[model samples]
Target: MRLKPRQLEAFRHVMLTRGVTAASEAMNIAQPAVSRLIRDLESEVGMTLFTRQGGRLLPTPEAVLLLAEVERLYIGIDQVARAADDIRQHLNVVLRMASVTSLVRPFLHRAMMEVVGPRLDLPLVLDVENSRHIWDMVEQSHYDLGLVFGPPRQGDLQTVHLHSSTAVAAMPPDHPLAEKDVITPTDLLDCRVLTAGRNSPLRRGLDRAFSQAEQAPLNTLETSMLNCCHFAAAGMGVAIVDRITMRAADVKLCAKPFLPTIDVSYYAARPAGSRQILVLDQIVERIKELLDEDTVIAS
Candidate 1:
């Protein structure tokens, strides 16, 4: 004998509420109809599910086991219903992204404008961190997408090179070295230099350039953010940063090509073996296009 949907629903409600009256009230049906559905469910399963005691119904051991399975089935059905609702209303969908601080304002802003429109009504969860933190979060699967610079970490991650950018020396327009088309390590020797910390690849590359040039850079401040460019624009010191960091047209700073160029390659990374999401893939593509366009314009 086949069990009907009403029979299973009535049985589940009774098992949950442990009372026929409550089950009937919950299902918006008469108590007699609830009893008939429960009776039909028991007959279809060919087992006695409950026993009457003191004007109350007590579930038998078999009924308890059956109720566990019925709850699991209902949970699956509820999930399907929620998924359908989300599809209909475009709810509960968020794109989680992690990126280095420098990439957040310029790179991501341009990519979002190109891919998701400038208004960006879609739910986007963004985390700004250092390059190392971005890589670690993406590697651990805490972030759905990561934008970072330099070589990507190996193992358990899929990376695609977005583009490469060379380092630039940012200085106030009136700074003495700003007259030079390209700033050398020797040009930084006498100036108070704003630098990235030792953890940054650009810092290490610059250190090597200084070593090879046999000049000592007088580093006045060390920071990880692109704010160093703003400081340079404010005449604090000469700041060496990625070319992208100098792209803001309002900064009023001269970005000169740095000598012994440090080429930092940016990458779009995601956890390996994760299911491909269409939106994330499109975002990656848009970033690549924007970066390529910037490269062309710079050249």
Candidate 2:
């Protein structure tokens, strides 16, 4: 039996909110109407979608799997609608972009907003994924642009340098090392080092710095989450993090420039033959403008 789009929407809402009352509020419908929609959907599918236990709605495995597909369908529907609106208004095409987690929060997103401002009629779709995941999506032509922390070695992709910044040693404000204006890798040899996962470029730089100092590999605490590195530094463990990450006001971490700075580069990559390369080039230019502005103001 084919499920109606409205029924699928109701199912997704219930699965997301996990409570009929919450789903009803979100859908802007009465609770009884929401319940009826769910019941109809379950009957049409010939299966129980959610399990009720202790007043909590738990999704069955089948329902969870279906919810994932429904999310993608809805995202595509939204994109189509926005594209139509953009065409009607004679607006520049919306460029779908994806970026690694490292550039998500304050860098790439900020730069995009500054570049487009309120002038663009089409909504830019930005997806944040890990570096490897973003590259895979780029290979599939799922995104027009991909922002990554490191260079792309593949021949099929063309990359343009966007910005570069040096990594700094971060420590809690009250930590002993915070008193120093500049920190060296040797200074951290005896301290616990908080770093990103082994595969991340930031971690690779940290490793190289220690190797150059001829120190035993640091007592590393590896984490995949960038926020965890911030917290680790705030809690007294020394972390080598990009300058943008050290700027969080709530972190209470003092950043000291590394004696031999580790340079990190950001690149915008696009399929070499894709027509969307023009959009990527525009974005890369905007990124350079912002970085240059920051450098001039700082100087």
Candidate 3:
């Protein structure tokens, strides 16, 4: 009863694709061949992997447990293949990075340009995702690193605090609140407020602030903090956003220090035990340098 790689691969594909026909196409094997592999795997493991129902393969309880282990195994194998490709030095080593949209444009882009040399054709695979998605990708080892706001939601991740900037109130220069040195929820009582979506950390904190002031965001418009700045600049509404995102946003707006000094933190999250490569380390350092610079515009 020797377990084979091909058997596990077939089992994995079948479970993933949910049918032998699709699994065969994915693995580039005939339908019967895929079926045979599954049968062999099932016999080797002594369990019913799947129960066929209406042309779909429904995994048994045992199969579900095995699939998790198989997926983890394949992730390691994929990492090994990538390492081998790096060793071969055929093309430039691909750096897979994922970050929230807030950091993608001016911050991460600039960091990569500064870190990756001009003559060196370092390949980059970047995904602009939400913080949660970026966290999952980096934790699952799908990405080399992830840039996210606040600490990671999941546990056992190594988080490097890149920068901490106080949140600011953004508005058009012509707006009346522009005269104020500091903007508060009370100041925004008459103005349309563009803010983070409800339940988000920023939103929750803002809600608390508004509660303390005995005020609410009237004429509320929900959007990301980056978009909040851009929209506010376009005269849509005043926005409350971190100085980092405000600085990064390519817009002309007045950024007054928001009241109560709400601080936002950015972090680079990676797998807990993963080893840092030289190229990634340099990119991370460059990002740190870029963030440390003050580029926020307050008109």
Q: How much does each candidate deviate from the true structure in C-alpha RMSD? A: 7.5, 17.6, 15.1
TM-score of each: 0.72, 0.60, 0.67
Quantify all predictions' global Cα lDDT against the true fold.
0.82, 0.74, 0.82
- Model 1, 167-246: lDDT tens digits are 88888889999799999988887888888878788888888888888767765688763778888888889998877666
**Candidate 2 runs further than 4 Å off:** 1-94, 115-123, 248-250, 276-280
Evaluated against the true structure, the overall lDDT of model 3 is: 0.82
Name the weakest run of 10 consecutive residues (lDDT summed) in model 1.
86-95
Alpha carbon deviation, residue 33, candidate 1 (Å): 24
Which scores greater on lDDT, model 1 or model 2? 1
Error of 2 at 264 (Å): 0.8
- Residue 228 miss distance in model 3 (angstroms): 0.9
lDDT of 2 by residue, 1-299 (tens): 98888788778888888888988888899988988898899999898998989988899998988888989999999999987876665366666888766666555667767666686555678887767777777778787888877756567887777778888777777888889889887788778777777777777777787777855445767775366456665584777787655543236677788867678777788866776434456667876676667557645
> Which residues of candidate 1, in runs, are more than 4 Å off?
1-72, 81-91, 117-122, 248-250
**lDDT tens digits, residue span 1-299, model 3:** 79999999999988887888888899999999999999999888899989978877899999999999999999999989988887565246677888877787787888887777584656778888777677878878898889988844668887888987777888988999999999988889898999987745677778778888876666889988888988999899999887677777878888788887676888998887977677778778888877776443332
- TM-score (C-alpha) between model 1 and the true structure: 0.72
